[model samples]
Target: MTKERIGHPPHPFDPARDPVHKRSKQGDSVGGAVVIVGGGYSGAMLAARLAERGVASALIDRGGDFGRGVAYATLFEGHLLNVRSARMSAVDGDPGHFVRWLETHRPDHADPDGFAPRRVFGDYVQHRLATVDAACPGLITRITGTVAAIGTDAVVLEDGRRLKARAVVLATGNPAPRTAPAGASERVIADPWAPGALERIGAEDDVLIIGTGLTMVDMLLMLEGRGWRGRATALSRRGLMPRAHGPRPDVPAPLEAGLLEGPLSGRLALARTVAGREGWRSLMETLRPLTADAWQAADPAIRGRIVRHLRPWWDVHRHRIAGSIAGALERLKADDRLTMTAGRVVAIRPGAASVSLDWTPRHGPARPALTADWLIDCSGPGHDPARDGLTGPLLASGRARMDALRLGLDLDDQGRVLDAEGRADDRLFVLGPPARAAFWETIAVPDIRKRIEAVAAALQ
Candidate 1:
């Protein structure tokens, strides 16, 4: 055994091509320990928690830093965490863990309520994993490769390497959005966070961004940070921007009485009732803690109704932006530098210098074709794993199946992956976004941290 750097491995290790394996007839095995695929926040926190309990685990991820993944791997200085530092802890029971770590590590921006740069958070995740690795030598194995398929007792890589383990966890984060419409300009960027995605845009070139969620906010900020002076148009079904976080009062009133007691008719009724009393923002906060249970208790038909009728409204209110970022957006709007429209793009015509988008307004007649120098897709990730190449194999072979809502992979209450036959696999577990179908609120750090802690305890 040789000592090597945990994260910055000398080179990518292909398990199938390991020369040392030739010395023995045994196939590649991680000693039958828990092997976590995807080293994002979910995987890193899971591995760290397991290590804390004296359990060694194997972590496998694709390119980039082990823990950053897509969200925190942003190189743009303007990309900030949507949540405050106080609530972004990677571990349960350690509420101030992330802020405390930042105090010693980066005192300049260590305020508990401050929203830190996303890359800083990424560094925090990597540091957490690194600390665990240091305390428990040889307890965490970092593998750099993608898992092509999952076997009953092992994971097979794309290169034909096998890692035998007692259990496997899929923490694979968000998948890239689907490809752009045909005949669209080559300048159309499906993944806004992709490296050099915004590099080719000129200072005065007009831009059109699809989707008006947090991802669109990120793109707007990135463009503004780069001193983009071109006109920008954001299109979505509702064209609603995320709300801004505000100063919390010293004391706040409890949620309105009977807000959650009565028979639920629909999201609109609930929203109007709550908003009439405590306001929509407060209503969201009040429901945030109970979202998982509320979602679980509701029948699939009710959930589907909410997803169809109230998702956009709930999304804008639920996922908010930093006050500063919201202020910048307002400034952009005030200066006529940005415009948001509620419509759906019907067709795209690409020209040599610009692309024309034909869209129909939500309630009005179809508008004239709008042209832009660049088009970006900020519609967020596709939720169907059965359609994704990486996770499709598992679904095709009955290792996993889509949930009723098709929002994410199906899993049991204990985070165990349910097979196509609807049987929980004791040896397989899932964490993070893929588990959203089972746990609607499983994507965020707070929700994922609890899930990771529970899964770690189960594995231990």
Candidate 2:
């Protein structure tokens, strides 16, 4: 089975090594079951597993129902997951679970591992929910409401309702992208996640994008689909692009033979570890479980250093490009329709028809002006805010502290939320992308699935 991408050396599970950090469970209990918040992939997977074990759970979401988090809430028929289906599984051990599910459901399927549309994945999650629900009638429940407050062992709903359970799981997904620097005119489009945003802008309108990460990649593909013929500019801190993943290899891992113990020299250190061990893909596959250890072992001073100096490169290395999507981006580059500039947007001034961005180059005083008919903020997901999502309100009120790295909420080694006094909340558990500060590579599906499963077991 395929593992999550961690890019560290591997190790077989050793109970003696105690990879799992311990938690203090002596404080409080709401009795027999737990309530899962944020019903996306993480919530769905955990709910399925918990219900399978005969433990009842309340799967709650404020969105458009089950499986429709930020990623699947769109009305588009063709929005796709960046990663292929083969690697996207709700179960931690069953790597091909999603692929097999799609095969059984969609008989006319042409590509299983290929990037399928968002609706297809959403349907699969819905099917799993139905399957799990049918297996355990009255054992699992779904609630559609926004959570206004999370107490010790209870969640207060916005509608003045309360849900009390033995434990709580926060599987809240990534937040939406922040809006672009606003101008007086409509030339600047802030919320790209809004429905029909890409469709409203025509192919002939010149556009400017804020960031150069995956969101930019999605927009680039969308533009290609719309036959956008006008010039585009992607401006970011580095203007660095993402790297593409290689072919999958099934070689048995040789990295599990104790090669990960030292201060690795460079890229060659990685090469030597994987020597005669596995293909590049195989090596990466084995390293998936050890990245957190590596991240924790990494110097804290250097941690911020890495974020400042090497974040762009790290993002490209971790978040690879799909082959077909890469081909589309290549065509855009070849046609001279897309240009990536490394600079800072000092200000956005809107004219009668177009928006002009005042720019300053890296270490150069020659500040030039760049203009676009329309501007979209592709700067990636939001962090803490006052919205009704996951981390916003708690952070705003100091119920929980943000990580020193500013990565998400402060969490313990076992994924317990650390409150304002730096103590783990006994009744609360946290998982998903925002946990990245504590568990560096925990955002992806595979790693997140394992964490959810492990935490579920711990709760049991």
- Identify the runs in model 1 with alpha carbons over 4 angstroms from their true place: 1-29, 179-185, 249-253, 266-271
lDDT of 2 by residue, 1-460 (tens): 1122123222122112223312213322223458888888788777776665555678888864786576666545445666667878776666666777676666554265577777777777777677767745665678888887777667878999888878888888776666564334677777676667777677798888888888888777777677878888988888888766654423436554343554444533564567445555555556666777766766666567657765676677566666666777777889998898888778877777888887787666775688888888888877553454556667676667877777678888788888788988767788787678778877677678778877777665
Model 2 alpha-carbon drift over 4 Å, by segment = 1-33, 73-78, 108-113, 179-185, 247-286, 363-365, 385-398
Candidate 2 global CA lDDT score: 0.70
TM-score of each: 0.89, 0.82
Alpha carbon lDDT of each predicted model: 0.79, 0.70
> Can you write out model 1's per-residue Cα lDDT over 1-460, one digit (the tens) per residue?
1122223232221122434323322222376778999988888878877766666689998884799999999888788898889989876766777887788778877998889998999999998888767755666889999788788888888888888888888888887666355235576877777788889898898998888888889988888788889988999888899999876511232665455555556445766876777666677777777788777777788789878977787778778888989999999999998899999878767778788778899988778988899988887776678777756888888888888888877888889988899999989898998888787888789889888877976876
Give the candidate number with the greatest lDDT. Answer: 1
lDDT of 2 at 219: 76
